[model samples]
Target: MINMHYTACSLLKITFKSLLTFFAREEREDTMPNTEPKLYKLQKKDLVACILRVFAKLVLFSFHRITMEGLEHLPKEGPALLLPKHCTYGRDVALEAIALHRATGRYANFLMRAIASRFYEWAGGIKIARPKDVRRVPGARALNRASFEYIRWLYLQGEVLVAHPEGTRNPYDMGALKMGVIKHLMDVENEAGRCIPLVPIGIRYRGYWVPFSRIEVKIGEPVYADDFENIKHLLSYLREQISQLSGWVI
Candidate 1:
């Protein structure tokens, strides 16, 4: 009976998503003007994207009942890097995006895996290659470079970029950290001549074996780039801090 209920809910979610996609496409088609307007018009696709993201947040919050702490530590203004622990498949990304938006009233540009780029492209996300696979594909290499360039532009434009330095979901166990976050910070520092504030976010899921388990997100104080000797040490310290705060042993 529980399995049947879970299956029914999953099917309902898929049906809703299909309906949203159909309407979004129809809205985009209907808004086309032959003359080409002077200013770009926002289409239904944009609205659909926002609505879909909100739907995701509602589902997550309903299931997990996330309680956020230290949200006040995030800067009210200026570009910053939000580094969160990777967990629970990809749900953490949605959790962080929604939480950050709620706190700052600014949408975060998440640095997502290249594989998820197509889905996120619709929602205005920047895709970065997993550092391990950066050397495998030529196109990925280009995309990685382009992704960094875009991130740099966004930072200068004063937007927050959320990155997961662990590179992949760690399944609640400690995993080796990647250097993409460090590299991006160093580049930004070189261009801006100062390190951007790095906010460490820790997400914990209660009862992974149970369906619709609770989630807790702890946002830590922003760590300034100048506090560490170099990018390596900075990332190491950030990892340790996040682990300590989240009660996850690294």
Candidate 2:
């Protein structure tokens, strides 16, 4: 019913990710004595993320022809925000994660759905409530505030953060950009008087979900809040840049 090679690859992938989670637990134990809140305690080095990056890189390399440009734009240190094109269902997430990690030598923090938070929190994921959750789920607003606080701490710590403006996977066409995270970042900047770079990362796949296909990622120069007159202009510029880089329009 299943091909042996496919099964083997699947198992290997699972093992690698599991190993990363295990190390995350170990790292947690070694951190400064838990006075800080659970999610905000920063490890000196994200060992789990480093290993996962290498593992993901190897796995991706074995299956795809990957190329990246404008890596120079990725900040060596952070307080950096990245907005990348969401292409494939799941593979693009791995591709972008590994690509950014290997290029910048830093693990990126991501804003993810509240439902998947526990599974990915150990690996730099910050859970944020989705729109539907806000309308229907109890305490969703409080959850959002907590998550935003964590994200603010991450920024203060100079951690790289990635949030897809499109909000969800859009195969080959760009979709409407969401402002939730961006607005939060703008607030953080205004309050803290800190200017963080907003880097647009565009990922294009030659064939969607096709093994051995070519993947091209273009990282554009970082844009800062000072560069835009207003949030509306900034959003429009980001959309334009991402679309141009990903070879997708609208």
* Residue-level error in angstroms, candidate 1, position 123: 1.6
Each candidate structure's TM-score, on Cα atoms with residue i matched to residue i, is 0.81, 0.85
- Predicted candidate 2 versus true structure: per-residue lDDT over 1-250, tens digit per residue: 1244355458656765576466544322311121223556863347656655666677667767889998888888859899999875446667677777667767788776765423366667676777876787777777787778888888888888888899888885898789888888889888888999999989998864456778899999999978889888999999999999999866
- In the order shown, the candidates' Cα RMSDs to the true structure are 6.1, 5.0
lDDT of model number 1:
0.68
Candidate 1, position 65, lDDT: 56
Off by over 4 Å in 2: 1-13, 16-40, 43-45, 117-119
Against the true structure, candidate 1 reaches a TM-score of 0.81
Cα deviation of 50, candidate 2, in Å: 1.9
Per-candidate Cα lDDT values, in order, are: 0.68, 0.75
Residue pairs with backbone overlap in model 2: none
For candidate 2, what is the lDDT?
A: 0.75
